[model samples]
Target chain A: MTGTVWDRGEPRLAGPDTALRAELRTAAQHASGNVPVAVATDTAGQVLEGMRGRAFDSAAVVAVLDGDRLRGLVTLERLLAAPAATPLGEIMDDAPPVVAPSTAQERAAWLAVQHAEPTLAVVDDAGRFAGLVAAPTLLGVLLEEHDEDMARLGGFLGTAATARSSTTEPVLRRLSHRLPWLLLGLAGALLAAVIVGSFEEQLGQEVLIAYFVPGVVYMADAVGTQTEALVIRGLSLGIGVRRIAVREVVTGVLLGAFLGGLALPLVWALWGRADVAVAVALALLAASSIASLIALALPWLFHRFGKDPAFGSGPLATVIQDVLTVAIYLLVATAVVL
Target chain B: MTGTVWDRGEPRLAGPDTALRAELRTAAQHASGNVPVAVATDTAGQVLEGMRGRAFDSAAVVAVLDGDRLRGLVTLERLLAAPAATPLGEIMDDAPPVVAPSTAQERAAWLAVQHAEPTLAVVDDAGRFAGLVAAPTLLGVLLEEHDEDMARLGGFLGTAATARSSTTEPVLRRLSHRLPWLLLGLAGALLAAVIVGSFEEQLGQEVLIAYFVPGVVYMADAVGTQTEALVIRGLSLGIGVRRIAVREVVTGVLLGAFLGGLALPLVWALWGRADVAVAVALALLAASSIASLIALALPWLFHRFGKDPAFGSGPLATVIQDVLTVAIYLLVATAVVL
Candidate 1:
């Protein structure tokens, strides 16, 4: 037996020669009871009739092949609106989305994102039909990478199939998969601690400054995450959303202006230092909102570069946002308050 | 002649029947040269022969239906190791993921984050297949809601599709859709800033304390953003992670420790106060990391609670993190410097 490279410990590929019809027949022949029906395709005429009479739902699709060569497919959905006299080709979407064998998993994921479809047309290196990949499968890869433990958490699903693949990974494997990320996070924390301590004289001068640290950081994080989420969601859903990506910046600016409006008064009210509040809020709001726009900009850039946007999260967005945020904060404080 | 009530501005439906097949044909007809291939079900033998011959790109899938109801679907990727003679019913995965009509745009956007092959089988009210929704269409809805005024500034997609619907409407519609959320954030920011600023007397007692505010806040934001990015990405990917949402908290603690270590060394090196440096670094690291974790944790919590995680970002995460961060910073400063 060949060693299967499993995704989430479930075999992702069976073998090239696997056939469902024969397997089903054999399963039916070998065992008894509750045999599933064979799904078939419908021609345009048949589909139309089915729809006209409202039986299209019962119809599946089949490829009307000529011997062993080329042919078109017929499905009830396409058939319903298809003219009774029209041939399958005339009504068929002649060119379909295709995937190649040499295509990287990430590439397939890119196709899934670009086509805005959950599935892709998979072809071999020779441009031959290989197999199709659905969006969920691609998503599964991401989830598997996210948490060895989340596979057990059932991440927004109720199915045993996905559940099994997600949750069945052994503890050791799960730990191995996730531990590195946690360790990296630990390292990041250390770096941050050092930066803060290095500036102790500055902090020691202002105890009140310490109280705002968590809130400012949290706010910036929230802004960055939200902006990133929006842009990514936009990118994932709309393949050519470079236009939307830019708009995110504008939205961020507006959000900053609005947030600044609220933050300024409150900061002043809380500290009874109107000048400090105005200065800090103006800078903070601008940083927070703009950070989100910048954070969200990556998905489009990654796509333009033929990279996977979903794979990046904690590594860059956080670091960049933090550095810029600090610069803006200090600058604003110096220019306005100091 | 009828409008597409569901999307509001879909290209005109080509025909009358609202049935899935009819609707798809209508869209296809309207699209003409732009019409892509139609994806439909294929019997087991057809699938085998197709793959063996390298026919169509494995972009299309074979959906298994039981009397108009979706049983499961098989994609090209699934066929690689599948038995050559199996019936699709035997191999088809039943209970595939689905999307309901009433699902929010944000939720739909989030769902698009699946890494595996994912498809949303649009079903009619009867739970029968209506049509397939590609991810782009869903994301387009949100992008369309975005504000765009200038081409260079990202106001439009530069596609003629916008001509189909009056831009004035979506913009106006957004006022209602987005204003409330912005207001909520504003209120939160205002309230927090006011409460915090009221402590001006304490800060005035030590003007130096104000100088550290910006630096400490930026550190927290940086950590929080990273955490938020991870969680957002994980959720979008459908990773079954659960404990990590909480377990991630440990990331802050560990980070704090590292930062504290550095802070102690740096402080002693810079100011010749080993104890103050050590204490402040420890305090800053702990507070900073905690702020980062909270920034991340809150969005997931909001998403889990059925709110848009994007909407969850702006005020709440920052306000809460800052509040806690400030308290921590104040405590540390008073204990050591005051």
Candidate 2:
């Protein structure tokens, strides 16, 4: 027998609210209450008769409710395949995957994917059924988030619309999307110039030290970029930076050592200046090792502050890495060469 | 009256092939042919009875077939709402979104999303029904492709598996994923060093030029990275580079002019050298403008060769931008400052 089944009049589906849709992009915002619902004791034939004239946002699955609470879910396929006299409760999935209405849109979509459920159920704090996030909405969220992440990682303002319009967007709109990040990058670039200017004395004495600046900065950025991509993807999948920080930093150091070992002899053989070679190799080691740390740390900070972690990957993080790489390269050059 | 219909005996579904699944991830590879299928003339009651005893990979949508040829599709909700004697042809949607079995998985998923359909039908070259790609499979494909794009854009070897395993992956395995690109980056870096070395005479005469090397290179890489991300996302969305090339290059030049205008006065005031400032500003303009051209071209070449265009975004493009920036900076400095 079904436990505590209470009928609450007719099953009225929730309708879209344009005002609420304009708010935070949460599960509650996207969850549509327009799906079909049935009472547990209803026979398949009875439910089918009731559904005949009603419109549903999604009819793939039906929520079986006991009063105001969700009891289980039954896919329409199951309902069609069952005997006409079979009770809804007998064919319903009693433990379908459910999330609170406050869940992040990406997290909600991810849970649906992990559960391999076509639609996700959203329940309220008081354990009342809110609605279901249908397949199309879930698909839209995934694509939108993908576009946003790529835009943020590429240094464009994080707008889902930007990704779609970027190809055909007028040059002015494209500039508006790309300029904010580049301006920030320019400030960091000037700061890098200041840092190098402070090291002009050493460079004036040993002009060879200047030759490796671009090389060193480029290598560190390459290493840091790899870490940023890994961390961003991991974070979106519900893995935190703290979980992978140690291993990632270690990978950075090992990579530095490998690259440095190769560079030391190569620079010495090509340039025939052992001190310059040592400085360049050592700078590569330090810059590469620190690159991953900064990469992981910036995203972690952004995540902690409730910003998109992907914002830490592109222009902002690149500038930070460039400044630090220049400082490390010069500080090491001054130490080893002069 | 319904169009010409042929009967092809029993509706047997295609089974998974392990060998084929290991090859190129395509629509055919992930599609499940085990979905429910019914002839157009079958009654709702008859189709329901036929589906009762059979197993289906996905029962969300039933293919309405004319023999082996697809006639239409019917969601379970419509079938459930119909009278028992209602022929499926009356309820079936004759124009459901569909793709060839050889279509790319991403394209198939996009079609499903565009059509707002939970499932996609796949047909063979000769137009026989091949399978239905279920919602879950489409969701998985989106997530997998997202991870792969992030990995490739972040400069990790382009492997979908690498994105999932990177967080918990052992350090050695991590190195394997990261080193191939870093080695290529190192070669590029050393080449940058050679480019800088060729400018040693200019640097010794005016050591101030060395101060802007990191700054200029960083800015160009930042600009180039934005275009790369835009181009990569655009390419995946089926927008070819040629469509956006003129507008993108124009945006790049405009961005360069804007950044250059800002840098010129600031450098002159900070360093009190108009020649060095002019060189820096002009280099900024030239480097920033060329960055987008290289960014768009590399990815276009990769796409033309049937490679994943995401590869053109990260270390490869960055190094090319860096080398060119350095050469442009010194060339401008020699022309203006000397």
DockQ each: 0.10, 0.60
Error of 2 at B223 (Å): 1.3
Query: What's the distance in Å from true for residue A221, model 1?
Result: 4.6
What candidate 2 gets wrong by more than 4 Å, as runs, is A1-24, A36-54, A64-95, A125-128, A160-162, B1-24, B38-51, B65-72, B81-94, B124-128, B160-162
Give stretches of model 1 more than 4 Å off: A1-73, A76-87, A94-222, A237-242, A264-274, A284-293, A296-315, B1-259, B284-318
Report the backbone clash tally of model 2: 0
- The top-ranked prediction according to DockQ is 2
Residues B1-338 of candidate 2: C-alpha lDDT, one tens digit per residue: 32222222332334454344344366776667667788888887677556653446677778898877889998876775678788899999999998876666777777788788888988876788877888878888887778878888888888636455777899998999989999999998899899988988878888888889899999899899989988987887678899999999999999999999999999999999998889989999999899999999999998776677888878888888989898998899899999
Error of 2 at B21 (Å): 11
Model 2: native contacts recovered, as a fraction: 0.72
Candidate topping lDDT: 2
Per-residue lDDT, model 2, residue B295, is 98
lDDT of 2 at A30: 75
lDDT of 2 by residue, A1-338 (tens): 22222223322334454344344367877777777778888887677556653446677778888776889888766776678788998999999988777767877888888888888888877788888888878887887778888888889987636466777899999899889998999899899999999988888998888888899999999999999989888887678999999999999999999999999999999999999888888998899889999999999998887777888887788889999999999999999989
